[model samples]
Target: MSKEYLDGIIRRSLEIRNKYHELERLHHGSEWTVEEDALAYLTDAGLVGRNIMSQQQRWPKAGSQTELEHKLGENIWWLIVLAKRSGIDIKDAVNNFLTETEAILK
Candidate 1:
């Protein structure tokens, strides 16, 4: 992706993180650390996995694909937030990983 696209993602992710923090402060009287946020999103990703399996089996309680998509987006947002908090440039990190993987494959 272009740098513009990555920057937009980072901007939107930070907006989402701020909004969530505000809501969390109102509901729980505190915001969680980046580590906690990451863990929570990871747990949500697991739920998405369960939903996928249930849908595959045609189970009654299975969540819709839209729900899974939303959860996946949330997971990405959480990752961006964590990276920001940890002083890492998410775009650079992703690019480095892709480059390393491609070199390994070659």
Candidate 2:
């Protein structure tokens, strides 16, 4: 897919996840907790980590590209949800840590 199309999907995903967070805040679900959303995010994180290692041929496990891509996409979607929940811009948060690392290590 083209970068433009990908950006549209990213923005759309964020919009949907943000709405989910709002619903969560209102306790719209039967349960009073947003544990489901949190779980989905964590699961995606683990899968994506595995996918990265697999891509690098360091996983020492079995998996196909199609599955890996899905995991990676899911991970990205969840990361955006996490950022939204924390009131953080994903790009800004990464840049801040990268910028501070030099001083911290020096």
The global Cα lDDT (0 to 1) of model 2 is: 0.73
Name the top lDDT candidate: 1
In the predicted model 1, the residue pairs found to clash are none
Candidate 2 residue lDDT tens string, 3-106:
58756876988788767667776775443234576788788778778877877898876764677898877777877666766678866776799989977998
lDDT for position 35 in model 1: 76
Task: Write the residue-wise lDDT of candidate 1 on 31-86 in tens digits.
Answer: 98877887897898897787677667755564567786887787888788988989
What TM-score, computed on C-alpha atoms, does each candidate reach? 0.83, 0.57
Distance from true location, Cα of 87 in model 2, Å: 1.3
Q: Which stretches of candidate 1 lie over 4 Å from their true place?
A: 58-60
The C-alpha local distance difference test score for the whole of candidate 1 amounts to: 0.84
List the pairs of residues colliding in candidate 2: none
